[model samples]
Target: MSRSLVIAPQWIGDAVMTQPLLRRLHARGERLTVGAVPWVAPVYRAMPQVEQVLEFPFQHGGLQWGARRRLGRELHGRFDTAYVLPNSLKSALLPFLASIPRRVGYLGEARVGLLTHRLKNPQDKPPMVAFYSALSGEREGLEQDRPVLRLDAREIDAALAAQGLRRGGYLVFAPGAEYGSSKRWPVEHYAALAASLQQPVLLLGSGKDTPVCEAIAAAAPNCRNLAGHTSLAQAFALIAAARAVVSNDSGLMHVAAAFGVPQVALFGSSSPLHTPPLNDAARVVWLKDDPGYQPPLDCAPCFARECPLGHHRCLRDVRPERVAGLVQGAVSSA
Candidate 1:
């Protein structure tokens, strides 16, 4: 029996994208374990591939050293191989400390010595999910084109009942991104889209996004703010039940893809080429730079927390009608 461990990515979107790899590993019938942050543990709790879900105290930077040591001690001599999905120097430290013989990960940050099987990162990756799926199999060819996420039917039913979602149709709007304001679509644009939807809209986000959700809900009479009320699992459950999801490029967009829900994703400052949603039922809308309409002096897509130029035109220029049209088309086609 080949005993294996996978260190899951911290972001919800990345976690969802890693599901296909986990499923492939599970199908091999290996003794598999997953090391993940506490918040992300629930997402994989029900995955049959995971023999155990190990939690690491992560959120705070200070606890990482101690957590790595503790995890290394607890999992020492337990797994024959460990696969790390996140491409961070710090992520490599734990499995190495745990003394796992074969640590597999992409070649990045000059961690060649740290990883036993260091796969070269793919050139011009098709999608983020596709890129991650390549890490699992030996064939080196893309194992699968579609990303898969397994959601319990009971959980879906419960979320539907709790949210008072109609049986056949509803629209979901996720208006937050953890990366930064640069990745977020304008909330008013979301409100305009919600107003145009034929079905009632359910706003999804975390506590930090409540204010934005509230503003959209207030603007659209049929919209309801469900942010900050549901757990991460519940949020996915709700998304799974919706007819279509209109979102910014965020974790929920990835969750929507996992569920195979129709989605219209708005992008600004972030490149869809690097991390496009991995669902066939999804479409991405982005702004093409116009020389005459430059709103800020800073480089757009700088991938920064706050816009370097102070004014944010990359996101602001995208109209609400454009997003609404895309969402409407997606829902109608589905």
Candidate 2:
């Protein structure tokens, strides 16, 4: 039996995108284990392809060399090969210290010496699912293999009860993008969209989004702000049962895609070419450059958290009415 370990991505969206790689490995009859942070571990744990999930408690960008070394020691000789998913130098440290014979990953962060099977990242910058599955040497049929999450039905039902929510007939709005404000559509726009629709709205986001969600909920009486209150697992269950999702490019957007929920995704400060949703059910609305506009949209998708130029025309210009039209259509069709 082929035994392998994968060092998962730090971001929840990226973690969900890694499922295609897991499925490929599983198809080859490999026994896979995942190493991930607490925030992302549940994603992998829900995948049947993963044999085990190891929690890595280190904070982002913090070296925590000692912790990595200790964990590496504990993991020594347990796997024959390791797949380093993150490009950061630190992402490869554990496998290096663990003495895994075969380490595979893109040659990034100038950490050349750490990996034995160093692969070059393609210059084309394919969608995230394709980018991740490239390491598995199976590029064909990847686009068709959408990310899948298997959550306990009982847990999902319990979470809905706790949130005073029910399955089906409700619309979900994810207005926060952890990437930065640049990626987020204006909260006022979300509020306007909420007001336009008659269906109940569940506004979702992390603690960072509570204020924005509150503003949206306040503006639209039909919207309920659940940002910062629900755990990631609960959020998954909620998205799984949503009638349709309207969101910025974020983790939950990917989650909705995984569950085959029809979604209207807004892209700003990021390129859909880089992280487009794998599910065909999603409709991407990318309006980075609108010709003849007052502010030249030529410099959009700066990929910055905050708009460097102090104007987020990339998102701000894509008015609420446009998005509301799409949502109305989705709801009506559903």
* Candidate whose TM-score is highest: 2
Model 2, 121-156: lDDT tens per residue? 877767888888888977588666678888889978
CA lDDT, every prediction? 0.79, 0.87
* Cα misplacement distance, residue 111 of candidate 1 (Å): 4.0
lDDT of 1 at 71: 72
Using lDDT as the measure, which candidate wins?
Answer: 2
TM-score of each: 0.88, 0.94
TM-score of 1: 0.88
